[model samples]
Every structure is written in structure tokens, then in C-alpha cells.
Target chain A: MIQSFKMALKSIAGNKLRSFLTMLGIIIGVMALVILVSLVSGATGSVTDSIFSLGSNLLTVTISDDKGAPINLQTLNEWMEKDGIGLIAPSGETSATARYEGNSGSVTVYGTTPPYETINGLSLLLGRFIKSSDVDNHTNVAVINETAATELIGYTDCIGEEVSLDGVKFTVVGLLEDDEKSLTAVFGRGSVVAYIPYTSLMRLSSEATSNITSFSVSAETDMATAEAAVTSLLMERFDQDDDAFTVSSRDMLEDAMSDVTSVLMILLGSIAGISLIVGGIGIMNIMLVTVTERTREIGIRKAIGAGRGVILQQFLLESVVLCMFGCAIGVFLSWAVLRIISVVVSSLSISFSLEWNVVLIAVGFCFLIGIVFGLYPANKAAKMEPVEALRYGG
Target chain B: MIDLKNVSRVYQVGSGKVYALNKATLHIDAGEFVSIVGPSGSGKSTLMNIIGCLDIADSGTYLLDGIPIEDYTETELAKIRNRKIGFVFQSFNLIDKLTAEENVELPLIYRGVGKAERKARVAEVLERVGLTKWSHHLPTELSGGQQQRVAIARAIVTKPSLILGDEPTGNLDSKTTGEIMEIFRELHEQGNTIMLITHDQEIAEQASRIIHIRDGVLSEVSI
Candidate 1:
């Protein structure tokens, strides 16, 4: 084996350019694998982050009938207690034009109770969010988001300022921070948000007054179990009407997106893997030529009593050496290229991530390709009759 | 010792059977030197190949040092060849990439000799060919005479029972041929069994015995 290894090295060294050309396929194959797998991982990572951020441990309950019962706080508390859930935030939204100091523009007002901040992850940039007192008292105080405060009032710190929705005047109690970036991070693409008390909004004479569309719930443990419990509770409550309420969680959506990303990566990676086949074919092609060129050498060795196994090993080892050399070069080249690409795409938040597992798999794949493709030609050389091979000529 | 009884080798040439060897038979005891001479296509090489175990006869028994040739596997034949026979081609056939000593060590390597022993034997054979100083040079760096000396060194490094030379000086001029033949004659004088095949009558005449092959038939010639 050692002797065969030495001969293989010598043979490759003897034909430097041909050996390099044979390695090109492996280089391309591994490079493609690293870059494509990294991109897919990055994309899936971003998607999972957004979905997980939305509500990794939370479940959403919604009923289209809006019987004013499924979304009520009493009903939410009942389900929360039954399921050992910790928080519930009832949420509703409306697009309305607002005016302040002669500045007028549209604002999306999310009406919810006091638990919205903790449950829905709405943090305040200034002042305070809507409290339970404000909801119970039906106070006309509002929590305008960063966009609404700036666009409508021309003031980032607009607490205690008066703003009119249509014809109703209300005091801005809090300025909600902009969640536009986080939203884009979740959905891969965002706008702005505003908040007000659900009770105060119901006083605006909406036809669905006191009716609820959706409420978000959170449990302290075991999301799968919590989600199932919540879904079944909602289903049983809506026994009067089937398919009226829908309960959903982020994990299911995450799994779906994960599957999508996996299939996508495999498809793209397979396309890239084709280059490995092409590379293997190149190695085989060059190896066959090398066998023919070294026919007389094979003859001499055989005549000197080198066995068929030795000749096969020598040729097989040559191809393996070439492929593995190519793999090393490919890995280094792609790592360098990915470094440069990451630097260039830094502003775009797109990373070409090369993981160790991907590299190991690529290297292993390259070796298998070498053995598979190298076998036939090596066998051809090994099986040659000594006299016939020695007599072979131009 | 070498023995052949009715050994026949046939070649298919353009859909016709050409008798490269036709019931040819010969024998040589240990420590004897003989030469086989013939014109082109007269089966002289076919005979040498069979004797050297590089080729097998189609329909006869060949006993080399008491081992039946045709009945053994290629692997077994290779082992027998490695231990009992050495080959010297007219073209030298030294792998040019290897140094002189490395070429001489080839058969010993196949024989699984230890590195220390291989080094000693290779150095001894290079000295025997009067090429101790040229052991480190590649085949291309050596002159034709020196290269043939390396080939002869390679042939004798294993100290095999039989040394077969095929037109051992065919590629050399008269002076180089004389130098290479001098090495073979020395080995023959040292009690080594040697069989040299040459078409030149002058080359064949130096052997103690000469065998002629004409139309694939062999006969002894009185020296």
C-alpha cells in the first residue's frame, strides 16, 4: 500500500496540468455545496427567527363569527386557566385618519388591553402603554406609535399631547416604538403600528361593538401541549358551529417553512452536486488516459512480478490523491470566496455560511466519487496480460 | 533448471493462425548459458517469454526449477518469476523517473525484502555492474552503456536462478553492446543460469550453446 501510494504521487506529479484539470470538477462541486448550503441556512435562520419572535411559545385563537364571546377577557381567562397559560392579550386593528396641530395622516390603531405590552411584545419608547384602568374607565387616552407620533404630531416625544381621531379628541399617553424592522425580519419583508384601549375604540360606534376577532395566549411550558389544549378548548366552546374558530401557533408554521427551506436547499444543492458528477467523470476520463499511457509501465511491473492487486491499487490511489487534493483546494478557495462575499453583502444581511458538517460531507463525497470512478480504469490496467501490455505500441 | 515438452504458442493475425511456437522443446540444466537466435516472426521471442514466465504456452508443460508453469495462477507465476527469473529487455526498460539504485531495487521490493537488505543488495548489484557511482542518477541522465548496466543490475539484484535477456544490446552501438554482453558473460561465468535471445549471429556465437528457431521450429546448432 505504501509503495502504491508513492507511485501514485509520482504519477500525478509527472502530469501536473492534467491532474489539475481532472480536479476542477471536485473544486466546483464542493464550492457550490458550501455556498449554497450556507445561503439556505442563513435564509431559514432568518425565517425561523421571525416566526419564533412572533410567538414561539404563544398560541393565537380567532373566531370569524365574532359572537363577542370568543375574544372577551372572561372567555380568554377561562381558557388560560384551563390550559395553565400565563398571559392573554386581545387585539383588534383599524385604519383611521388622525390630526394633530394641523398635521393629518392615516394611522393603524391596534386596540388591546393592558397585557398587550407583555403578551404581544409591545414596548414603549416613552410615557406608558394603555392600562387596565384606562380600558375599564373607557378613557380617551391613546398610545400612538413612533410613526403616528412623528407623522401626525411632528414630535417623537408626544406624550400628554392631544390628537383627534376623525372627530374624537384623545390624549397620547405613550409612544410605541417602531416594530417595522422586526416585522420585516419575521415576514422577510414591514410598515408601522399604533395602540389604543379596546373599550375606548368600541365607544366609536363600530357595528361590531364589544365584539372580538382574535386574542393571543401564552403558556409557561410545553407549547405543543398548550397549543393542543387551547385548540380543543376553543373547538369545544364553538361546538354550536363547526370550523368557526381557528387556533394556531408559530411552531407549526415554523415546521412548514423549515420543510420548504430543506427541500429548497436539497434541490439547489443537488444541482450543485451535479458538478461533482462532472468532476468525477473528468477524473475518470483523465485516469483512463493515464492508464493507457502507463500501459508499458504496468507491463514492466507485472513482468517484474508485481501482482494485479498492486497495479490496481497504484492507479486507484492516483485518482484518490487527485480528488482529495482537489477537495482541499476547493474548500480553501470557497472559504476565501465566501469571506469576500460576506464582506460585500454585509450591508444586505445575506451570509454565505459554510458549516463544518457540509465540508465533511463534501470531502467524503469527493472520496467516494474517486473510488467509484477510479475503479473501472484501474481494473482495466490490472487485467491486462503482461505480454500484450508490453507489446502494446504506437 | 528449465524443461519444455511440446510447448506451442499460436497468435491470431488477420483472422489467420500464425504459429509463434510449434511443438518447440528445449532444456537447460542449472549454471548453463544458452542463446536462442532467429529471424523476425520466427517465434524466438515467444520462446523467451515462455522461458521467462512472461507468457504461458498454450498446450504444453513448462517446468521451471521443478514448478509446473501452465497449471499455476498468474499470481503464482508472478511469485515464481520474482524469485527465480530476471528479465533484461533490449530497450533497457528502466523507469526513467526512478534513480539507478531504485530501478535495481524493483524486484526485491516485489519480493518483500526488508529496506535495509534491499539497500545492501541494490548497492552490491550496482557495484557488480560497475555503476556504483551512477546509482543516484536517473535513467535519462546515464549513457546507453550505463543504462544497460543499470538494467543488468536490476536483472541480477534478486539473485534469481535464471536471467533472460531479449536482444539485451539491440539499442546500443557496438561498443555499448560489447560492454553489456561483457556483464552477461561475467554473470554466466559466475555459475548463473543465463538465456540470451538475439538475432545477430555474432552475438549468439559467444554463448556455449545456441538454439535456432525457423518457422516456429527449434533445433540445436553445433558451436
Candidate 2:
């Protein structure tokens, strides 16, 4: 076996470029596999992460339209304080540019009640969050996230500082940690956030503030009953008009995102897998050519005392080495490419983690490709008659 | 020792049976140098191949060292080839990818010789072939004569009991031919049994006994 392995190495070393070209297919195949696994796993990781960060059991209520009699805040609050509801933090949002000295960036100005941070798993990194008295007084006070602190103020711990937004000065009482899958970015230029009293934001609202974007509600018991209660409460309040308002659960969001990811994985996996099969065929084609090219050599070996088994072993091992070589190259390329992309585009929230199991599967597939494609050519060389093979020109 | 009785081989050329060998009987004692000389397609190669355990006769009895060839399985025949016979071909079929030392190690590797012993034996054989200095060169890097000597080193590295040379000097110049024949003469003097097949009469004359094959018939000619 060792002898055959040595021979395989020598044979490959004889034509290094040709060997690499032949392995191009395997490289592409393994690369596709790695990329596909990374994309799916990375997307899934962020989705599940966001869902978990929504705290233990949470429901989001959205009044999509508020043209007629608007949603009564007191009625909604009283209903949420009833059976399955543990807490409610109604919120509204508007896009505004925040300025502190010369550092001005677009930010999402959020209007919310107190329990927002506790229900939504948000933490104060430096100072206090918005309080109920601030909401009742309609104070021009703000609790800014890390993005606002860094992008506008250029540093952390900007507690008790004041930043002007939409030409109104608001005190930054708290510095909340940045929400890692930033939903605020979906509304504005991203990287800056501020939360003040809902009444203060509503009083300054233009046309966009008529409807609430969403308000988070924690379940007193579990998520299922909270979602059901929220759905039914909205259904009764809107005269059983299900389309008037929407209620979504963290579990539902997770399931939807997971389903999308599954479909994405299958589609990407097959496209990549097809390329791998193409690469395996490429290996087979080259191996067959190699056997033909080495027919005379095979004859010589056989004449000089090589058995059929020995010839088969030598040829098979040569192909196996070729595939594994390509695998190593492909693996390195994929890892490097993924690392660069994640680092260069840090805000993408799409991480490219190394999936060892996927890599192992790809490696194993390389061996399978080696054996399946190599057997025919190796056997062909092994079965040749010495006299006939000796006469072969190549 | 080698024995043959009424050995024959038939090839299907298109739709006709061409008998490359026909019931040609011959014998050679242990430690004798014998040559079979014939014109091209006169069954010289057929006879050598059969004797070298490289081909099976359709109908005949062949015995190598007292074991009937027909009784052994294909794998057994391979073992017999690996263990007992050394072959030198007309083309000097040294694998182009292998260095001279690696080429010479082929048969010994097949015989499962240990690394240390294979190294020692390969050095000794390369020295015997008078090409010890070129032992590390690839076949393509060596001259024709040097390549043939490497092939010879490879053939004898296992110290195979029977050495069969099929037109071993067919591809060489007259000078190189004489040099290779001198190596054969030295091996013969060392009491190694050697069988050579060639179409050249002068090459045949160098052997102690010459046998002629014409139209698939074998006749002994005193040398």
C-alpha cells in the first residue's frame, strides 16, 4: 500500500499543472458545498438569535392602519393587563437625523412606554432607560443605544448628554447596548437610535405616526396563550376584522425564517452539488486518460512482476490523492473567502462559521468520487494482457 | 529449468485464426543460456512470452521448476512471475515517472522486500549494470544505453532465478548492443539461467545454444 502511495505521488508530481487542472472540478465542487453550508448555517444562526433575544415569551401587535377611530391606548393597555398579559410597552417610530457638534447621522427616534427594555431583552450599558414619569410629562428626554452614542457622540457612556434631533434637543439619559440584528436600520440610514416618551414622539409626529409600528407584550403564562389572547383581543376590538390588525409571535417568526432558510439551503445545496458531480466526472475523465497514457508503463510493470491487484491499487491511489489535494485547496479558499467577506461587511449579520461536519462530508465525498471514478480506469489497466499492453504506444 | 511440450497459441485476426505458436516443443536445463531466434511475426515473441509466464498457451504442457503451468490459478501465475522470473523487454520499458533507483526497486517491491534490503539490493544491481552513478536520474534524463541498463537493474534486483530477455537490444546501437550482451554473458558466467529471444542472427550467436522458429515450427541450431 505504501509503495502504491509513493508511486501515486510520483505520478502526480510528474505533471503538477495537469493534475491541478484536473482537480479544478473537485475544487469548485467542494467550494460550493462549503459556501452553501455557511450561508444556510449563518442565516439560521442570526434568525434564531434574534428570536431568542425577544425574551422568554413575547407577542408583537401591529395596527397596520389607523384611519378611522384610532386604537385607544388606554383600552389596549387595560386589555393587556388582564389574563395572559404580563406587561405591555407600546412603541412608535420615526426617522430623524441626530446631530452632536459636526457628527450628524440619520437615526430612528422611538417613542415607547417603560417596560420596553425589560420585555425586549434590551440592557442599559451606561444609564437609565425611559421612565413612566418622563412619558406622562411628555419630556424631551431620550435613551440612546450604542449606535447613537458611537456614531453621533463618538464614544460610549454619553449619559446625561444632550443631542439635537429633528431640530429639538433631547437629553440622553441612558446608553442602551446596540441591538445586534438592528431592526432600526430597516427604518432609516442605520447606526443611531433614540427612545423617548411615546407622547412626546406622538406630539411631534407627522403623517407616519398615525399607526403604531409595533408594541411588545410579554406573556404572563407562556407565548402560545399570549399570542391567542392578543389575536382575539384585536379581533373583538376590530369587530372580528382579522385584517385590521396583525399579531405575531416570536415562535411564528422563528418558524417562518427557518422555513425560508430550509428552502434556501436546498436550492443552494443542489446547485453546488451539481457542480461537485461535474467535478467528479472531470476526475473520471482525466483518470481514464491517465490510464491510457500509462498503458505501456502498466505493461512494463506487469511484465516485470506487477500483479493485477498491484496495478489497480496504484491507479486507484493516484486518483484518491488527486481528489484529496483538490479538497485541501478548496477548503482553504472557501475559509479565506468567507472570513474576508464577514470581516469586510461587518453589518451584514450573515456570519460564515466553519461547519466542520459539512467539511467532513465534502472530504468524504471526495474519497467517494475518487473510488467511483477511479475504479473503471484502474480496472482497465489491470485487465490488460502483457503482450497487448506492451504494444500500446501510450 | 523450463519444459514445453506441444505448446500452441492462436490469435483471432479479423475472422481467421492465426497460430502464433504451433505445438512447438523445447527444453532448457537449469543454469543454461539459450536463445530463440526468428523473423518478425515468426512466433519468437509468442514463445518467449509463454516461457516468461506472461502468456498462457491454448493447448500444451509447460513446467517451470517442475510445477505444471496449467495447474496454477491466475493469481498463482502472477506470484510465479513475481517470485521466479525477470523480464527485459525490447523497448526498455522503464517507467518515465520513476528515477533509476525507483525503477530498479519495482520487482523487489512486488516481492515485498523490506526497505533496507531493497535499498541494498538495488544498489548492488545498479552497480552490476555499470550505471551506479546514474541511479537517481529519471529514465527520460538518461541516454538509451543508460536507460536499458536501469531496466536491466530493475529486472535483476529481485535476483529472479530465470531472466528472459525479449529483443533486449533491439532498440540500441551496435556498440550498446555489444555492451548489454556482455552483461548477459557475465550473468550467464555467474550460473544464472538466461533465455533470450531475438531476430538478429549475430545476437543469437552470442548465446551458447540457438533455436530457430519458422512458420510456428521450432528447430534447434548448434551454436
Candidate 3:
């Protein structure tokens, strides 16, 4: 058996070009699967990590009127003293054009108090976080993301610089790095973000209203009791139906992200699966031809003393070797693609991990293709009568 | 010794039955050099195939060394062919991808011989066939006569009891023909039972006895 294997290897080596061509289908199939799966997994892992990094126990609560009525600040102030919620950071957000020097880019200005930074896990890279005094005194101080800061001041410290939004001057108190760059919205193609005090923002902006766009909340330690208490508080404050607004916990958001990613992965995997089918068909086609071409050789071997089993082994081995070599090349290509992707999306922490089980499954599928495609040829070769095969040529 | 008792083979050829062999019975003792001479379709090749265990007789008792072979399976027949018989074909069916030595080692490979012993035996057989110098060369690189010698080496390397030649020198020149006959004469002298099939009387004359076949029937003549 070992000797036959050596002979088989020599035969394949003898026809290097033909062997490589035969491996083409396998190469493309494996590469497609590996690259698509790794990319999807990397994206999924990044999104999941970003959500958890925002603090797993975090929740968001917002109250809106059924008829879209303006929020009454007096009622909201009473609700803010609700018994169940431990922390609430109301935020008002709007989009505007910002100009720094001669370069201009569109940016979203988030209006929020100092408590919003701690609730949303925003940290300062330079200087300090937004202060309660700044919000109370209605100071026009801003905390910008690293991207915004870099664009406005280059590498110079922006701690004392002023950035103008719509010709309104705001002193830079701190620079914050955007974590949501990793947890991007569906249609958001990465934009710069700047933050300022909600009171100052409301006073200067024309579209400002008492209607709060959203609020991040940290419920008391007893979430069940807090949920009930907050529900009644909102009902009393809004004086409307119980279902007037929506409240979502971090776990719920994570679950939704997981579902979306799972569907995406399945869709991508099926797309990759088409190539494997093509590859398997290619193997079957080549194997059938090989059997026909080697019919006389099969006869000669059998005439000399080889059994049906030996003939089967030789051809099956050839098929598997072709596919396995292609799979190896595919794995290498996947890793190369990931390296390129990481370079392209450096701001987002996306890692293409190697899953051994997935690789093993791919290998198993390759072997199955070999055997499934090799069956017809092997049977035909095995059933050949030695006398007829010897007599075939003459 | 070999025995055939009422052996016959029939083939279904498109609504017509072709009698390849017709109830032919013959016997030969050990170490006999015999020839079967006939034109195409005369069943000489069919007889050779049956004797070599390449095919089974339709209805007959073929006893090789006192064992009935018609009852044997295909695998059993292959083992018997490898151990008891060798074949030399007119076209010299040496595997083109194999070197001369590797081609010669094929039969021994089936016999489950160790690699060391197989190599040693292959060298001895190649030397005996005057192919030692060309042992590393492929069949395509060798002359017609040399390629036939490689085929002969491959046949005999397993040390089979009987060597069957189907027009072994049909493709050779007259001069190469005489050289091949000399090798046959030497092999027969070494006590190997030999059977050859040919249409040429001059080639058949080299054997000790001749069997003539016409339309699938055989008649014997002393040579």
C-alpha cells in the first residue's frame, strides 16, 4: 500500500501542470468560504465587543407624547426625581456643518450634561470631562472626539483652542474618542462627533425644544422594582398611555445585534457554499475523465495482481490530494485578506480569528467531495474485466 | 502441468453468438515450449487468454497443477496469473511514466514482496534481459527492441511458472526477431513452460510443438 502511494505521488509530480489545474476549483471554493466567514465573524465580534464595552448593565429610557406634544420641562423635572432610576442623562442631538481653519466637514453635535459622559462611558483623552458648573452656567464649552480634534488642531493640544460651529465659538474643554466608531449605525459611514452642554446648546439653537430626543439611564440595583417604579413615574409625568415610549436594556440590543450578524453570516456562508459545489463538480468531472484515460492501466494492474480495493485507493487518493492542496492555499489567502482588512479599518478593532473547527469542517467537506466524485470512476475501474481491458487497445 | 477438459467460450455479438473457443481440450507437461498458430479471429488469442487466467472458459474444467481455475473469482484469478503465468504482448505494454526498473518491479509489487527484495529481484531480472544499462530510462527513451526487453523483464521478475507470448516479435525487424527467439530458447532451456501465439510459420517453427487453429477449432502438428 505504501509503495503504491509512492508511485501515485510520483505520477502526480510527473504531471505538475495538470495537477495544479485540477486543484483550481478547490482553491477558489476554500478561499471564498474562509474569507467571507472570517470577515463576517470579525465584524460580528467587533460589534459585540463595542456593545459590551459600553457597560453591560446600562439601559436607555425615553418618554414621548402620543400626539407628539412638546415635552413640559416642569413635568420632566418631577419625573427626573423618580424613585426607581439611579441615573438619567437626557441628551438632545442635532447635525450641523463645522468649519476649522479652511477645512469644513459635517458633524453631529450632541447636547448633554456632565452626567451623560459617565452614563455613556465617554472618557477624555486630554483635559477634563464636562462639568456640572459648565452646564449650570450655560458655558459654551465643547468635548470633541479624537477625529474632530485632530481635524481642527492637527497634533497641537486642543485643550485651549476654540472650534466654531455655524460661526458660534465654543472653547475646547476636553477631547473624547468615539467608541461608536466600532458600533456603527446601519447607514452611518463614520462621521465626526462634538459634544457641548445641553443648556448652552438649547439656548443658542433655533430648533431647540423641551422634547428630549433620548436619555441613557442606569437603573437602581433592584432592576425589577426600578422598572415598575420608572414605568409609573413616566405614566404620571407624561399623563398619557403606559406605552407612550420605549425602554431598551443593553442585553436586548446585544441580542438584536447577534440576530442580525447571525443572519448575515448565514447569507454569506451560502454564497460561499456555491463555489464548493462548483469545486466538487469539477472534481467529479476530472475524475471521470481520469478513469477513462487510465482504463488500460487499470486493466494492466489488475492483470498483474492488484485487486479491486487497490485500484479504488489509488484514484481516491489522487482526488483527495488535489482538494486538500487547494484548501491549504485557501487558508493562507484568508489570513492575507484579514491582514489587509485590518489595515484598511484601523480605527475599528476588527479581528479575523482562525476557528479550528471551521477549518476542520472545510477539510472534511473536501474529502467528501473527493469520495463522492470519485465513486463513479472507481466503480467503473474496478468492474473492468482484465481480459477485456488487455484486449481493449488491440 | 496444465489441463483443459472440454473448454469453450461463447460471446453475444449483436444478436449473433460468436464462438471464441469451441470445446477445445489439450494437455501439456511441465517445461514444454509450444506454439498456437492461427490467423485473426481463429481463437488463438482467446486460448492464450484462458491459459493465462485473463478470462474464464464458458463451460470447461481448466486444471493448473491439479487445481480447477474456472471456479475461481476475479481476484483469485489475478493471484494465480501473477504467481503462475507471465505475459509478453506484441506492443510492449510498459507503463510510460515508469522507469525501466520500476516497470519491472510491478508484478513483484503485487506479490507483497519487500522493497529491498523487490529491488534486488528487479535488478537481477533487468540484468538477465540485458536492460541493466537502461534501467533508469523511460520506455519512450528506449529503442523498440529495448522496450520489448523491458516488458520481458517485467514479466519474468515475479518468477512465474509459465510465460505466455502473444506475437512477442510481431513488431520487431527480422534481425531483432532472431535475437528475441534466442532469448526464448534460453528461457525454455532454463525449464520454464512456454506458450506462444503467432501467425508466422517461421516464428512458430522455433517451438517444439505447434497447434494450428482455423475458425476457432484446433489441430495439432509435430514440429
**Which candidate number maximizes TM-score?**
3
- Ranked by lDDT from best down, the candidates are 2, 1, 3
The alpha-carbon RMSD values of the candidates against the true structure, listed in the order shown, are 4.3, 3.5, 2.9
Q: What value does the lDDT take at residue B61 in candidate 3?
A: 90
Model 2 clashing residue pairs (backbone): none
Q: How do the residues A113-206 of candidate 2 rate in per-residue lDDT, one tens digit apiece?
A: 8888878878888878888889778899999988778878988878878898888889889888777764433223465778888878987667
lDDT string for model 2 (B106-221, tens) is 88888888999999999999999988898888899998888888888887887778999989999999999999999999999998999999999899998999999997889998
Report DockQ per prediction, comma-separated: 0.57, 0.58, 0.65
lDDT of 3 by residue, A1-394 (tens): 6766676677668778877787788878877777777777777777777777777546677655634554543444555577766666777877777777776777788887766777787777888877888877889888888878776667537887877887888898888865653455322454578888877778767655556757776665655655666666666655657677767776778899989988987887777777887887887787788777877888788877877777888887777777777788777777687788778776555666665555776788887887887677777788888877876765
> Stretches of candidate 3 above 4 Å error?
A62-84, A100-103, A154-156, A177-191, A204-208, A222-243, A344-349, A353-355
TM-score of chain B of 3: 0.98
Second chain only: TM-score per model? 0.98, 0.97, 0.98
Error of 1 at A88 (Å): 2.7
Off by over 4 Å in 1: A49-56, A62-85, A92-111, A122-126, A132-183, A186-212, A220-229, A236-242, A347-352, B14-16
Error of 1 at A238 (Å): 4.4
Docking quality tier of candidate 1?
A: medium
TM-score of chain B of 2: 0.97
Selected candidate, larger lDDT, 2 vs 3: 2
The order by descending DockQ is 3, 2, 1
Best by DockQ: 3
